[model samples]
Target: MLSPSRRRRRAVGLSLAMAAMSVVVLAGCAPGGSDPGAPQRRSVNTRLADEPITIKLYTETNYTLYEELAHEFQRQHPNVTFEITKERYDVLLQNAPRLMASDNPPDLVRLDVQTDQVKDNLLLDLDPYADAYGWDRFPPTQLAPLRVSESGQRGEGSLYGYGINHSVTGVYFNKELARQIGMNEPPATMGEFEELLQAARDAGLLPIMQANAAGEANMTYQAILNQLLDRQTVEDWIYNVPGATIDVPESVAAARRLQEWAEKGYLNSDANSVDYTSMVGRFAAGEGLFMFLGNWQAAALDSEMEGNVGFFLFPPEDAGRPAIAMSTPGSLVIPAKAENPDAAAYFLNWTLTNSTARQTVADVGGSVPGGDPGRPLPDVAPGSVTEQTQEAFQDVAEGDGAIGFLTNATPGMFQNTLAPQLQLLIGGRTSPEEFAAKLQADYEEDLAS
Candidate 1:
């Protein structure tokens, strides 16, 4: 549902960008892009060569899902081995350009912010592979973020990557506490949601356990913004569409709503100081009744909270409107310079088709596996939050309400602009109007560079 990692992986989307900004990558990922020399296309034929082959995978995500996938795949192809290097998700995004340009590059890399990679020719264009693998038939919305136009804009163009799993952003509440408060069903609208927040607060529980250190208050803010605007408007802005903007009245209104939440004691008093890990840990420890987070946290929560937790999408203002959530696939891409392009392509195809691979992600990764959308879903442990996450994802995917995280509107936008502005807004130092204007300004400045 979002970039915030769960279990063994986490990406502070804004932190990744603010840190990545200092590296000075190619023409600042200018919309006017470059065409890199293409990797040789893989044959769609069924068999792999018998000779020993090693696929190099670079990722910041700790191997909860990856190590298992690699081992399981290697089991099937005895000759195939893996060399994987784990980096912090932030470091991985920061050094992406240089790593991809080195004399030797990884066969596949986990890419969170790929605009720069795609624009600079660091990533392999996957349209050819998509054709070979029948990936062209997968849900278009699931593939939209990975599709880059000739101008480097996302949402439409040749496919460049695929998510092994897709994520969803929504509200996670303590099921035990929910029943105590006489709430049996998820709120049907925003008004109903706010009432629950008030009830949780009145019961002396933290209504929302979001942290501001990584600017996580923005998670709730984006949840509200998701419903206020249509999917295309937000996705267009995040995809760097030529004139797309988020400094609209709806954005301002969303900011004001969050500010009011902060002022009214819905947010924890120490939210400004708490970090994401602590917040999630505290929530699972039973300190908070509800939290805003991505489905990435589901598997971990399932283990820690056991059967105590439940998740739901942010409800729309009107029940008749579609439910929208901040979501994007956890994208994996083949480097343009990958040593074994065909093997990498074949492995990616297997992830989509292999039953064991799909189930491992659901059971271990706590994520909703992304494959042929028409295919049956893999089984999850009964009563695990994973089931709800998968259902929420279906609602968003079918509703076409999957929008990129706002923190990803531009690298550094969160750290340099949104973070400080949100902190100030919560502290009574900035108006919501000022907050929206400042965000758009920073976005424009980043794109201009």
Candidate 2:
């Protein structure tokens, strides 16, 4: 799972915990909706202490963009430095909770909060900082993941995490392949998108370049979700609303569609065997017409493909439908034991509000800089995929179409359900009925357990 670009090197990983999540369990301590055992509510202070301080970070190994941010922050605050520990994205998924619960946890760690880890009081509640910093002005949906409640539900709860740049997923089409297939612009709808897939196949080019291995097939599942389903339905499933279920017509259609595409040979022949990095390499090297991934690849493809790749939000079912994507700011959490909670919170706030830091996040991370929507956008080359994704994020935000990753319904949900079920569905070993039903069963089992 090496990064596609040395500059970004961040994984457009499935669900990035579970995009770059660090997990803590802080249950039932919601003073202003924060963990009870967490640090006492401090007055909101944006200024860093004018004393020698070292804020430790534990994060995904490829998150060099944040490292760059830390260095720049250090330049601004000579009194502050950082000690960052890096691990593979997958390894962090398995261990962030343990790390967060450790006596000497890093101040900030990259993590996505999952339902299973919602039982402990190990993460700081960020409500005080949010009010102090005017973070309520940010897109309400974008910050939904940061809020954990007394019940440990996702959308409404204490703030547990934040991301500097919000990562957005979409389609990256090879411009030349697109033209060869007679695609003059991004497909206007999923039907047109399918036609282009057929066109690419007829032209003897791989229609889509994606890896089904490592559970990435779920990307396809989630990519088309908003097109066929309502945002509330999706939110219910992801956030653990009682009686929320995935076994529905839209979800089944989505599963069936994924299998149909696979059966039609729109994907690479080695799809099930290929890894995400391989998919990026093939799409960038011109072997495929499109790729379904996030802006995390823009910095890489912008370099490797050299403007040959074009990006579009994965199309909706038809015209006028909002094209939602699964995204949030890269999830970072403050551990309850963090030595410099205020400094960590300040740095997180700085990452969002400071134009310089936002630019660094946008430029280095190839993600939409997370901040007040009114704040002007960071500079991006005109018509670049970077620009497209940033604009797309705005559209999604304005439309309120953003949603969490389906793979993150629970910890190991992907490994236990999505990956295996998707592999089976694509392999024709499972039908849409079976696939969706299995997903519902697993979701219920995990939630109950």
User: CA lDDT of 5 in candidate 1?
Assistant: 30
- On residues 171-216, what C-alpha lDDT tens digit does candidate 2 reach at each position? 8888987777678877789999999999888888888887877788
Clashes within 3 Å, all models in order? 3, 15
lDDT of 1: 0.78
* Prediction 2 TM-score vs. true: 0.86
Over 4 Å off in model 1, which ranges? 1-47, 61-63, 414-416
Q: What do the candidate models score in CA lDDT, each in turn?
A: 0.78, 0.77
Judge candidate 1 at residue 311 and give its lDDT. Answer: 95
Instruction: Give me the displacement of residue 405 in model 2, in angstroms.
Output: 1.3
**Runs in model 2 with CA error above 4 Å?**
1-46
* Weakest 10 consecutive residues of candidate 2 by summed lDDT: 13-22
